[model samples]
Target: MTRIPTLFFATAALFALIGMAWGIQMSASQDHALSPAHGHLNLIGFVAMAVFGGYYALNPLAAASRLAMVHYALTLAAVIVLVPGIVMALRGTGEALAKGGSVLALLSMALFLVAVLRHARGLMR
Candidate 1:
């Protein structure tokens, strides 16, 4: 019921819609050129966010922490940067955004890991 989980879940739903629409558009156009971006959108944007949301839902302690907000922001920023970066890369443009986004995504995951570990330790104690 925490805000973190709700935010994540809502964002995940939005990403799912976008990803599905993109998939359908690609299929109709018979253009699989953006397949990589499509896959990332579904996997990272939808699946990963859903999983993160579920985790926070189950672990309210972590979800309530300040770090949770940081994690969410970083993940969101990564997705924002990454999707466009992938599209640009597909068009043979620069990759700076893609690289930066990838790093931000990794950092977000690392923050989640830390939160998990801390929560687990608290539960054990």
Candidate 2:
């Protein structure tokens, strides 16, 4: 409904498309080795983002804050890095990317908690 929610939904849709494509590719090739990474991409990228968007749409105050934008950025970074990072880790590459992305994801969720406490409180009234 609002700008932030719209952005989030758009991002979620994109991630869903990517995840679906990856899934189809895997199925066609009969190689499920990267399924875990694919699952994370859909869960964190699509589902988490859509849930955030819904929350923001319902709580405009939370969506309006600068912290909301920060949350979105952190989430975007997490999905972007984490998927590839997991792939690398599974392939026996260095784990720096996965670790960094995991931290980013944690920070994103932490900021989201702050948003709920700080801005979404009005919903309780």
Candidate 3:
């Protein structure tokens, strides 16, 4: 019943591990140029996703809905693209992916708000 929550945690853990490794790598190389990207990876990919999972676990009614899955997908996509986007932008590649990923992140937050609002409505029933 908590498939989404479990998925979120699993993905978050992976992101956290990657972020940690990235941090260590940067430290070893004495290059903090990509710290911004690493920070986002940990904050968005690990912390935010883990928080989303906790929220879903607390509100299974919302978790059971399609919106939850969509939220997961969108959030995951945001993390996937956004981190790389930041890196590419930092490398002077382009701003396209960063812009797109920012939009996805915004949309994901909106969906999360919708889920929270809907859950509140259900609670009043």
Taken over the whole model, the C-alpha lDDT of each candidate is 0.90, 0.91, 0.93
Task: Report backbone clashes per prediction.
Answer: 0, 0, 0
Model 3 Cα lDDT, one tens digit per residue, 2-118: 999999999999999999999999999999998988998999899989999999998899999999999999999999999999999999999888898889989988999999998
TM-score, candidate 3, is 0.96
Best candidate, lDDT? 3
lDDT per residue (tens digit) for residues 10-105 in model 1:
999999999999999999999999998888888778888899999999999999999998888988998998888888888989888888888988
- TM-scores of the models, in the given order? 0.96, 0.97, 0.96
Local lDDT at 99 for model 1: 85
Q: Report lDDT (Cα) of residue 106, candidate 3.
A: 90
- Candidate 1: stretches off by over 4 Å: none
- The lDDT ranking, best first, is 3, 2, 1
Error of 2 at 2 (Å): 1.4
